[model samples]
Target: MTTAVSLQNVSKSYGEFKAVDSLSLDITSGCVFGLLGPNGAGKTTTIRMIVNITVPDSGSVYIFGEPASAKLRSKIGYLPEERGLYKKMKVREQLLFLAGLKGVDSKDSANRIVTWAERLKIAEWLDKKTEELSKGMQQKIQFIAALLHEPRLLILDEPFSGLDPVNTSLLMEVIRELSKSGVTIILSTHVMEQVEKLCDEICLINKSRKVLAGRLRDVKSNYGIRKLLIAFDGGDSFLKDDSLSVERFPEHYELNISSVEQAQQILRKAINAGAIIRKFELLEPSLHEIFVNKVTGVDG
Candidate 1:
């Protein structure tokens, strides 16, 4: 397995506060890797170090086997959480300039820009100033700019921030295609559902430390069968058990159970309580559930 990005005991500090502790992580090539954490958990700092926007105060950051440096950074495309664009500049001119900075030729950049804009359904807006577009439109433009040079490593922070469901699905499909084409992506987002659907591996950090890291399947499997989803009417009375964590919906309920024995017990109890069970099944722990548990220091 080739390594796309590697951090060795990396630490960063700002004034008296430590932004990142002695953290070490490896991202494999051609995979969509999730860098997830709650707000202010060193995710942005770590990404900055990887893209050479900020140097680590201690230890090292390596990209594609080379120490992160200006020369090596051209192979990286970074979309920061904060949106940045020359609001006054035309979208075409802005993208051409940014792509040029990454060593893309003017002719090639123009062609690629047209291709991307068409694919993203923003071709007609290219001649307009970025400030003239809506937030979602500007976001799509920025996303296009990031890939203009076709970098090997893509780092996206909150890539779906302003997108509606349709555009969000479009972007997700594009990201998966990019990964299939061998572009390694570092996705930093608070959206757990997106991480579950897109990422092959993930790392969770909190308070400047890693709380979890592994292949997505292995990480979820390690937690065992602890969740149950069922649809039933009149089962609300049986859900009063204090030991179970229940999330109620109009048509179904999700319950957290300890074991198979506990699940069977709950099923029987619900049935005997004059409830109709439309569906019942054990479920794998969701990424959101795992994230909340880890961050809150809750076991199982």
Candidate 2:
């Protein structure tokens, strides 16, 4: 497997503050890689280095194994968090400008503009001024311009911010299709659920440093506790078993057993309490939960 992006010992500081402190990460080809962190956690700084918009103070950023160069930027599509387009320019003209900046020819650029605009359902808005469009409409156009050249690596910062759920799902489909066609993506967002659904792997950053990085499945599996939720219609005293560390709800108890055999024993204990079990199920730790656990030391 080839790497689409690699950062090694990358560090960026602003006077007394280090925005990105010794950050290193690898994003492979043909998959969505998530950069998960809270605001002010250096995600945007790292991305800036990747795109060469901001040079790293003491590290290297390699795009496709070459030093981050302007020539290689054409192969990279970036949708920045702050949307930037000429407010007075027509959508089509703006996309054309961006395409030309990336060294795309006029005819081919126009063709791709049309194709992407139509696919994004903004074909009719091409001739209109960008300022005339609503925020969501403007976002759709910006997304088209970003991908008009069909770049192999996409760096999207908070791509789902302005879109409604319908449009969010729509763009998610596009991202998935891009990945299926071997376009590597580096996504940055605070939305953990989106990462859970979209990312193949993830690197979690905290206070300008990587706290976790691995395959998504491996991260989740390793971070999980095999806990179960059981709703039994009785007092908490019924579940005072030595094998289970059970917590009680208003009318039921959530049980945690060390093993599957212990779960069976818990079930029998519930029955012996002369209580009816309502909802009994295993619970998996969500990415949001894991993140809070790792970052805040709040794992329970």
- In candidate 1, stretches whose alpha carbon ends up further than 4 angstroms from where it belongs are 231-242, 245-253, 265-277
Model 1 TM-score is 0.91
Mind giving the per-residue lDDT tens digits that candidate 2 earns over 100-122? 98889999999998888878888
C-alpha displacement of 144 in model 1, angstroms? 1.3
Pairs in steric clash, model 2: none
Give lDDT tens digits, candidate 1, residues 63-109. Answer: 99999999986799989999889999999999999999999999999
Model 2: how large is the Cα RMSD against the reference? 2.6
Error of 2 at 10 (Å): 1.2
For each candidate in the order shown, give its overall lDDT on alpha carbons: 0.93, 0.87
